[model samples]
Target: MAQLSDDCFAFGGPLMSIDDAVGIITAKVSAVTETETLPLIAADGRILAGDIAAPLPLPPFTNSAVDGYAVRASDLPAEGEATFVVTGRVPAGSAAATPVPAAHAVRIFTGAPMPGGADTVFMQEDVRVDEDGRVVLPAGLKPGANVRPAGEDMANGVVALRAGQRMRPQHVAVAAAFGLTSLAVRRRIRVAVFSTGDELASPGASRAPAQLYDSNRFMLMAMLKRLGCGVSDLGIFSDERAPLAASLREVASQHDLLLTTGGVSTGEEDHVKAAVESVGSLVLWRMAIKPGRPVAMGIISGTPFIGLPGNPVASFVTFVHVVRPTVLALAGALPEALTPKPVRAAFSYKKKAGRREYVRVSLRSAADGSFEAVKFPREGAGLLSSLIETDGLAELGEDITKVEPGQSVGFLSYAELI
Candidate 1:
């Protein structure tokens, strides 16, 4: 793991913009140097450690894209249908025994390699066979039609995948097409996740009168897993300054990141800020965002640590904006910025200027035939139901203070946040 300087994330502003926060993490943090090779089957979600060059051209051979009659373009009549002798047949796995000659058509099935001297094809449905046993090809059937030239999809030796790319199923398919069984990928980032607060108790545990189940820890771990992180669930640490500080130091050596869900704010009960500072260093990030303004970015024993807000919604939102990019940087992956699609707002909203806000919204079909965003009825960061019932979020920029029905808004689906 790469260690950042103490001042790398240091900012003078009272409230940092989300973009500025992301930029600092991306620009200052260095990726871990370790990598591993895994079979392409298990490589999905892993980052590419190096470029993948195509071993051979896609398709590898010139073939027919459909069941057709292959013919030489020189033999076709320009203004009318032409009759030709059917000389040979080519199935997907079989080849023409001899080169197709001029003035002759060869029966070719989909995926069959095109025979030599044949530069065009006429779909079997578009031609007819007369009683004389000669096949007729239609006029204006352009030359080279229906023929899939070798390397048409991608040429040999081309860079098929680049370094720092997260492998999707489509990328795996491409690698398989190139006859590759495995790929070199960066190892999953090791992260230690926990929650902080004396009032919190682990789920399924006997709860005290003032205690609530620790939901943020489990939520953060799940989110980290989606990012291909090797997560160690450290459970909860009570709001004790000394004990919390000791635990943070103990785990810092084993993980690339230490993430806590609470105790980052300036409240007296918040020990995460002081704990981190005692162990190593801390930078309180008063981010200019809704539901997650009090974020903490720090370093403990050279490992990066981030403390998100305690509320469930705040934790979820801050994790998406803060911990996400930090993890990507550590894994050597390219920055995956979330881009919201434009949708019509069906509800009115008001927010302060200079602070970004994400409104939970479900999309519905509108009379105009386009998708419109409908806001959730209730509000509060603690309501987990809001996240479950919503399809995505409507992003209100820092400059915007209000919204009206039919206004254009940027919406981000939950599917792409990771």
Candidate 2:
């Protein structure tokens, strides 16, 4: 589990920037020390524990990159074309039976090893069979034009994969190509998720007249799964101060993180703030971000805790920025920057100058085939439909006060968040 001083996150302010919050989390939070070995196929999405050195050179041998005739560059006719007796055929996975004599060519398929004494290839489509059944070669063809040299992809004993990388399918392909059967990766971070509020009810449970079904907890769990976390679904607990405080302290030892949605703000009925204070230290961060301004981060028994807002949109937006980084840090994964793609904005909007805002938007192609961002028609943090109907967020930076159509703005796609 992560270790931290009670006052590590002591830096607070009336309004903090997202960069500041992330800086503290990255600087203070220690990655868990445990690690596990897994099969190559199961390594995807896990953090690499150490650098992976190539066992052997990629391709391992010199081979043909295309179906063609292999010949020595010196034997080619200087002006037009020349023909040579068809010496032998080399198929993929097979070696040459014998070296080709001068003035002879070999029929070689893609991935087949070049016959000894051959240093050039003429693509089959670019050459022809002569009347004598000999292979005709084109002039002006470069030697080694269609050959994959040994160690062309990577050399043996070189570091091919680095530590702290989140493994992906492409990375798996690299390992497989290097003949790796297993990999070492950091253990998945364990998380405990729950919610608190008298106005909230479980999805299947009977609801009181003033209660609505809880959505934040379920949404948060889904997000956590995407980050490769092992989550224990601690169902909605009582909002009463004593019970909530007791629950927070009891679960901190078993999990790397304790995550809650809602009940962190200073409301007359809000008990989470006081509840966390009783058992752990809390920092109520009012970030300079729209939709997710009020976020609560704390420490309990050395485990990190994060409390998101009650609003579904706010919860979703905050998860990508706050919870995602914290989870990566805990799992020993390197920081993955969320780089927004620039797209033309089709909607006009205005906002305060000093705060950063993410406008939910859908992208469409413009007249010139470029993508333009279209904002959701309605605006409210509580509207769950806004999240579903939109494709991603349009990032308006702190210096951006007003936006007009045709202006280029940074866009963060939903696919990039995880």
Worst 10 residues of 2 by lDDT: 8-17
Off by over 4 Å in 1: none
lDDT of 2: 0.91
Q: Write the per-residue lDDT of candidate 2 for residues 189-222, one digit (tens) a residue.
A: 9999998888889999999999999999999999
Angstrom error at residue 93, model 2: 0.8
- lDDT, candidate 1, 221-339, per-residue tens: 99999999999998877779999889989999998998887778788877788889998988888899998998889888888888888889988988998889989999999888799
C-alpha TM-score for every candidate: 0.97, 0.98
How many clashing residue pairs, candidate 2? 0
For all candidates in order, the CA lDDT equals: 0.91, 0.91
Angstrom error at residue 140, model 1: 1.9
**Model 2, residue pairs in steric clash:** none
